[model samples]
Every structure is written in C-alpha cells, then in structure tokens.
Target chain A: MSAGTDTRSVTRQVRPGESPAGPAAGPGKTPFSARLRRDWPLLVMAAPMLLLVTAFWWIPALGNVIAFQDYNPFTGGILGSPIIGFTNFAELFGDPQFLRAVVNTLGITAFQLVFYFPVPIALALLLNSVVSGKLRAFIQGVVYLPHFFSWVLVVAIFQQMFGGAGLIAQILRDHGYSGIDWMTNSDTFILLVTAETVWKDAGWGTIVFLAALSTIDQNLYEAAAVDGARRWRRMWHITLPGLRPVIVLLLILRLGDALNVGFEQFMLQRSAVGSKVSEVFDTFVYWSGLRTGDFGYGAAAGLFKGLVGLVLILVANKVAHALGERGVYSRS
Target chain B: MSRKKVSGLAPWEEPGSVAGRIGKGGVLALIVLAVLLPLYTIVLTSLSPAETVNRVGGLVLVPDGITFDAYRQIFSDSVVSRAVLVSTGVTLVGTAISLGVSVLGAYALSRPGTLFHRPMLFCVLLMFVFFPGLIPTYLMVTSLGLKDSYWSLILPSAVSAFNVVVLRAFFMNIPHELLDSARIDGAGEFRILWRIVLPLSKAVTAVIGLFYAVGYWNAWFNAMLYIDDTRKWPLALVLRSYVVDSNPLPTATVGVNGFGHVAPPTLAIKMAIVSIAVLPALLIYPFVQRHFTKGVIIGAIKG
Candidate 1:
C-alpha cells in the first residue's frame, strides 16, 4: 500500500499544477489530463498575456546580449554584431570617467542611506503622536504632493528657489550678500541632490512605516501605560520594538538597491554641473553611448553596473535570511 | 479586530502639562507655515504680472498684482499647448497599456505553483534588481526603430516590475477559497481574475493604475533620452527646455499661436510652462485621493 502511494505521489510531483498533484486527491484517481482538458479555456485566457510579456519584456531582455558586441544602431542588430569578447569591458575599466562614476554612485548611495532612511520613521512617529486627525491628514496630503511631481518639476522648483537668478539670490543681493551657487557647486552637488530626494520622497516613504505603526496593537501601548510608562518611554519600548521588523526589512531592501542611488535626479543635474561630481553609472551610460555614440562600450558599462547590483541584492537577501527576517525572496 | 473593542485613551486627554500643549500647537503651526511658504512663492510668481514679477525681483511673496497672462499663454495654441496635448495623450495611453499588462502579469505570477509560475516570478524579480541599464535599453529601442516614436515612451515602461509585485501581493491577499470555488466551477483563470479578483482588488488596481498614469504623466527622462521630434515632445520636456535651459520660444517663433504675438520673457514663459506641466496632475489628483492613501500604503509595504 505504501509503495503504491509513493508511485502516485511521485507522478503528481513530476506533473505539478494538475488535479492529481493535489495533496488531498486519492491515489486511485485517474491522471489530471481530463482536468487540464476542462481548463483549456483557462489556458486560452492566459495565452495573449503570455505572448505580450514574452515579446516585450523577455525578448528585449535578450537584447542585453549586445553587451559583449561591437553594437551599432545603424549597421548591426544584437545578433549580427561582431563579438568583441570583453574588449568593451576592458575599455570601460580603464576609463577614468568610469572609475569616477562608480565612486560617485557609491558615495551618493551612502550619504542618502545615512540621511534619508530614518526620516520617514521619524515622520511616522510624529504623525502617530499628533492629536488632530484633520491636521495630520492635511499635513500628509501636503507632504505627499511633492512625490507626485516629476524630477523635472522638482529640479525646476529647486532652480527657481536657489538658481543664479532665483529668489534666494535676489534676497541675498538685496541684503548685499553674495548669491550662493548651490546648483552648479560641485562640492555641494551631492548634498543638494540628496536633499531634493528627501524633499520629494520622504513623505511617501512614511506610508509603510505608518501602516506598520498603525498595526501596533493599541492595547500594547495601554499595557505599557498601565505599567506607568510615560509617552516617551512607551514610544521607546512599545512603539520602536513594534517597528523593528519593518525597519529591518526596509533596511535590507534599501541595501539591495543601494547601487541605484537616484538615476533621474543625477541625470537631470549632470548637464548643469558638468560631469565631475555628477558622473554616475547611468549618466556614464548616456554620455558614453547616446552622447558619444559608443553603443558597445556603453552596453558593457551598464551590464557591469547591473551585475554588481544583482550581487548586492542577492547577498543582502541572504544576510536577511541568516538574521531570521523575512527577506524579499522567501524560500517558499 | 472589532473597532468598538479597540477604543482607548483619547489624545485630547487632560493636558499633562499646559506649556507642553502650547508648545506642540506652536510647533505644528510653524511646520504648516514652513511647508506652505515655498508653494506660496511659486503660485504667486506664476500668477504675478510680468511687470510685477520684475519689480519684485522674482521674490513675490504675495502677488503685486494678479494676471492670468502666463496661464493664458501656456493654454493658447502655441508649441507649449501642443506639447501639453502630446503629454496628455501619451500619459493616458501609456498608463492604460501599462496597467492592463501589469494586471494580467501580476495575476498570473501571484498564483503559487502554477506551471511556469516560479520561473516567471524569478524573471520579474531579476528585472527589479538588475536593471539592464540605459545603453542596452536604448540600443534595443533604437534597434527596434522605436526612437522618436510614441511607443518609445509607452513600451519601455509598460510593465514596471515594482507595480507587478505590488499587484501580485494584492492578488495573494484575496481569500484562497474564492479562487478554489471558481476553479471547481470551471471558471478559466482570466474569468476568475476578471469576475472575482479584479472586482475585489479595485482599490489596489486603481492605485497602481494611477501610479502608472502619474509616472507616464511625469516622465520627461525617457523623452530626453529617446524622443527627438519637437512636434511630438511632451509638456515636461518642453518645460525643461524653457525652465531649465532657458531656451527661447520652443519652435513657435511667436507665430504658432496664429496671432503672431511676440514671445514673453524667458522667466515668464518658463513659469508659464511649469504651470502647464504641473496643472493636469494637480487637477486629476483629487479624483484619485480616496484610493491614493490605502493603495500607496499597501504598495509600499509589499515593495
């Protein structure tokens, strides 16, 4: 009886997603081909969708194969191109701008992770503590507005506020003080970009933390209060501990994405400041390929960046698992 | 989970300290004021007359005098106006396409243990971590002859992996029993998705759809990268040229409006352009406000 059951289960394992594969199904049941036959309409339903994704997403993904070739938009397609065999990679590594780009990308990511990461947590705590729901809602609306604005508009707003002919400069000139060049200043460009990111996104980031905070059983707070814990103590012990898992999860995710480091923001600013401090991987791709028309080299450089980011995410997710947090990719 | 059972000490409890309450109110007021001030300045500048704008040294905290000339010029049948229309069309079409693709894709992936499900899920997840970068993407678009085409804008961003993940999580949250019963009744995957999942998941669908719409609306980066035709240019890119680069008149030559009116100053035109770019999103936002909060919160947590 045991041997017969094992054969049935093995067949089910081999042909997954069928009725016979169901754990509850009896061993005496015929195969799930009949069930699948009835579900052909279901297969038909998924066909167009499968085709769409396969063509647009999967096919183009294969186009990344040009990273190894001497790709030319005018002359050769991804396949027809001559394989340069890591020559593009070699040229990329030797380029001074490439090195600068890597450093700049990492540097910006580090600064933002330090400065911008905790802001939403703090904002959520403040919002949670606020007594007036109306006031809190209004503030939430106001703060979230910036996140919806495009990077172009955000950068424009920054320029209007701080650019050479902007209001701040005019105010300073009226006071006989020198207009500070925040936009084009290479030294302060990183800070300016980071600040802009925070202004645009900090409020939006609060949504998850706020959601998690709201789920913190109110009774937990009450229980702490009953223990004579003051508001701050309750926040420190009950609230902070409740937010712990979320914080860890978000931190892991952020680390995984640490290499991204705000592509559009950097790209928009690159032209104004020149490429000294502004050169990052994305910009490098644009300048090298689109601007200079070196498609193969640019493809190789981009591929390199993607590979590094993938490694980071995988490692970070693995670390999260080891630490016993629910990482992004669960084993199940 | 009962709301009535969850009642607790009210926030307006007898003030633990009089000074503390006063301080809290003061701080709140200050924050409100600070946030409003920059937005006020932008609105005032946009509304102020050109003469007043100049007189105020572009620091018009309050409008010296109000005029809609800036708004008028933007809305008039100029290059700016055409760009606005182009942007509107692209955003609407792109958002619809993206949401449709993402909804179908997310539904399929959310089904655990379906044939080809895990591999496809892994593929989507890989796209998130390893962005194939700009050059390869650009090459692909160019090679496909999509450069300068509207598809350049719509196709590249049609299925954002982040949106897929969020929608999948939402699909996952739908009780398994409903799906089981539907399957037993011989409802096809798409039938079950449309009849059962889609109806129940409207909040998330609306929210994710809005996000795609907003992204498409706000997308100037792709335009900057791929689009070369000035006639096909979107409002945001046009705004960039006017506001960021301080470029003159943007191909209207003052004649595109048909009255042959002379172009305004670089600043006035720039402010006008900025207002044009921001106005639509602002208008459309209120309609989606109800779904916005819950949708965004769920999306973020899932992400």
Candidate 2:
C-alpha cells in the first residue's frame, strides 16, 4: 500500500512541509498560492470535517434568523415569514415559564457546582491515598463503568433503586412503613438529579484530577516533610495549588455549559416530575419548539442560549487568561 | 480497600491511622456496592423465575431457579431483535465515518505549516462555544429531506470539535522526526500517515473509536428527533420506550417462554430489556478502562 504512493512521490520534492528543527517558523510568510500547492493534501484531508461543520453548525446558526420572524413551517417557511424583529425575545422574557426555566437551569448549574463538583476531587484523593495499586486500579475500573452507561440505562437503574415499589421503597414496606417514591417527587427533584449525575459522571470526573495528582512533584512532599510540615500542611500547601489550574479550567467549562443541564435526563423525567421541575433550557427548547411546533419561539430560546453561552465562554476564557491559564481555546 | 499487604509508608508520610483507613474502606465498599448491587438485581431478576421476582416484590435480591427464559423471549421478539441489528449497524457505520474524518482532519490540523491550518482549526474550535440551536438543525434536516432517514442520525452529529482537538493533540505529540524520515524516504503524506502514524497510534485511535461507538450506541435523542418510523429505532430508544416510558411491550412477544405455560414475570422481561441495553457498555468497559487512564487523561491534561 505504501509502495503505491512511492511511484508519484519518488521524484517530487513535496517540500517536506516543515523541517524538523525550527518547525514553529510561521507559514504566514509564505504566499497563499504557494502554500496551497505544497499543502493541498492537508486541505483535502480537512474538507469533510469543514463541510460537516459548515452544513450542520454554521448554516443552522444562520438559520436562527427565523427566530425574528413570525414563522410557519408550511406557509411562510423561513424566508417568506414576515419579520417581527425581537418580538419572540420579548415574548420569551415575558413568559413566566421561560423565566422559571432560566431559574431552574441556573439553579441546577449552581447546585452541581457546589455539591457535585468536589466529589471527583475527594474521590481521587481517597483513591490516591490507598497504598495498594492493585486495589486502586480495581476500584477505578468499577467506578468509571457508570460513565459509559446510556442515560436511559442509568435512569432505569435509578428507578429500580428509588422508584415506588423499588428496593428502597420495598425495604421501607418490609419494615412496615409506607415508602415515598423518590423519582416522581418534585420537591426533592434537584437532589435526585444531583445524585443521578454523581452516579453517572462523578467517577469519570476523577480522571482529570487523578492525572493532575500524578503530575504533582513528589519531591515537594518530601521537602515539606523535612521542613517539619505535617500531612495536612503538605496537602493544603502543595496538593491544592498543584490542582488549581485543572480545577480552574474545568470550572470555566462548567460555566460555559451552565445552560445545558442534561436534556435527556430532564426529558425522560418530565412526565413523571412535571415540567415545572424538569424544564431546563434544552428541554424547554425541545418541548416548546419541537412538540408545540413553535419553531420561531423555540429558535429564539435556542439562539438566546447559544449567544449567552458564547458570551459566558468568552468571558470565562478571558478570566482564565488573566489568571495565567489557558481557558477553552488559545488565542493562537 | 482490600486487606492485602500494603506498601510501607514513605518516610515523609505520617503513620497511617487505623480508623481513617477503616473509614475509607467502608466508604469505598459502599461506592462499589452502589454500582454493583443495582447491576446484580437487574441481572438476577432477568435470570430468575416468576415466583422469585414476585416474592422479592420488584427487584430480586437473592437468586432462585435460573433460566434463560427472559433472554430467549427478548431475542425472539421481532421488535427487539430488529432494534439490536439497527443499533449494531448504526454504531459500526457511525464509528467508522467519525474515526475516518476525525483522524484525517486532526492530522491536517496537527501539521503546523500546512495550508489553511489556522482556518481549519478555527472552524473546529468555533463549535465549542456556539452550538447552534436544535430547531434550525432540525429544520435543516427536514428541509434537506433527511427526516426518518438513518443518515439524519449519522450526519448532523458526526464531527465533534472536542474529539478533533484531542486527536490533533495526540497526532502532534508524535515525534515529527519519524514522519520526516518517511518523507525523506519518498513516502507521501498519505502513506506516512497510513504506515507510520497509524501503526504508532493504535491505543489512542482505539480509544477514540470506542468513544464514538459508545456515543452512537447510546444515542436515542437523535433517533427520537429524526426517526418517526418505529421500525428504525435503535436499541437505546427502544430501551427508553420500554423502561422509562414503562410502556407494555407487545403482549404476544413478552412475558411468555417458548414453551406455552411457563410465563416469566413482566418485571423479569423489563429487567431483561435493561440488561440488554446495559450489557454492551459493561462488557466493553474493562478493555477500554486502561485507555481512559492513558488516552483521556493525557488529552485532558494537555488541554
């Protein structure tokens, strides 16, 4: 297979793209046509990805202009619809349900940041403390298994544990108490979702912290000990600081993703818990737009989410850069 | 947590406290149980007789007479059998397409001096922040006549910006010296990528391949969004309908053993569905677990 390419490649200079040494020499100095001649293969390689992104992402982003129109899918379509600029946004803000969704979405994001974010760090610390590498690896394997499970499967497994007539309910009944259904209760719905999120994802979250932990210089701990610093001192001074960069980066990502609080989890449970508790941003768009056929209204909500998310991500990335860390993307 | 001989504490480390170690062991045990106990009941309930499931009330704890009756019923059910095939086909095709496009694109972006590298990288990185709203994408799909088509599931979500970034990072970390030598040997970029780069990247490639495959296998929302045809539903969607929606499966298909009179419990049948949905993830996890520690950690740390 390689020999087939050797025939055409044998005599052609191919320019080698960049020499190994001083490879950072910017191609910006090269003329576009010359670079094109030398690097057409790379362009060919990237075409499919560029095409897919343009089709699905950029086009649909432009398509959000339907949000400003009084759209009818059948009659007006996207273009023929009469422009009612900002009317959809106006109505969206005025609607109490939309407001509730914003509140709920922010609430979930905040709640998870407080309660769920530290779990993997704590778990990693615990796992890292274990002296037996074999036991640690085994535990890590078992815990990370849940991250691979489909949300549908995760919910089913949770239902078997927390639903009416589920194991906990059964245990309560066996003890002569009438048990409450955990899955359907609107009051503690936040707790339930948090627990479910932790179960499904907290283990996976540990991987980054574990990686960070491994990178921390062990010699610092020895140095600290020789200076008469205790275990708590070593952890407080050395460990947490070492983890700060990764922690900051992840926290920034969580902020950027604040609006998207697990659409499928909320969608699957909407009927059971009522939309009042379950209507986060994504689910709200899905129900209002897709289910009610209010394409314009839904698109407005979606565009609201996308624009706000972009702003948040940009702001967060700026903060990261100020704090001497790379955020979501580099300026390069 | 196990009581095997632990490595002696390093001189810098404080003497281990017995109570703290015991507490850690207990907590770790609970975490493991929290995962395994649910899995145990689901699997056991699927295997148990009707009386055993009924006696336990809903989810079985202790085992009783084991049987393949539930599995037999699930396999024989036409809807489920068809769904399994659909899920398998979609996963295989989707993974291949994603891996191919992502690998090529990532390699392109990996090379620093290549034409349009910055523009291509920008195109991908832009996806990270500005997720176009779901409605327009849906509109685009419908307008393009992809409604109810399997292509709808594969095309729209095929190129993940994160995966592209991760794969690009991995490719860049490859010793450029290796590729330069191949280039000097008159190997074209394609040949170098095929013969040199890919052979060295088996672990990370397999890891990325598994990630895409799992995403495809576990995706139900796309199917729900685009597929109006029940016949085209993947296993994940089918699992959702039966388990989350708690819809009764076709009576003729469920709750009956191949032999006439031995009716397995409905709970067993539901548990059976859950098992079928979950089993693949569990089976594939151990093999991929090492890659998570290696591939995902390195990618994450680098980012």
Expressed as tens digits, the lDDT of each residue in A163-185 for candidate 2 is 99688999999999998899999
TM-score quality measure for candidate 1: 0.87
Say which docking band candidate 2 falls in.
medium
lDDT of 1 at A102: 90
Clashing pairs in 1: none
Instruction: Candidate 2: give its CA RMSD in angstroms.
Output: 6.4
lDDT of 1 by residue, A178-231 (tens): 898688888899889977877788777777677777777887776777777887
lDDT for each of the candidates? 0.71, 0.80
lDDT of 2 by residue, B1-303 (tens): 343434456866776577877898899999999988999999999999877887888888888789877777778778788899998898889999999999999888888757666677778877866889999999999998999998888999899776776676667778888887887788877887899888888888888888898899999889999998989989988888887788877853433354774677778888998888888788887787788787755553454
lDDT of 2 at B122: 75
Writing each residue's lDDT as its tens digit, candidate 1 over B1-303 gives 122212333542223365665666676566566455666777777777667777777747866777776667766546778888888899889988888878878776665545545576666665555666677666667767988999898888777766776677667667778888887887767788899999998888887887888889899888988889888999888877878877777443343344454443446657767766777767876777667656745443433
Per-chain TM-score of candidate 1, chain B: 0.84
The predictions' CA RMSDs to the true structure, in order, are 7.5, 6.4
Off by over 4 Å in 2: A1-25, A326-332, B1-5, B252-258
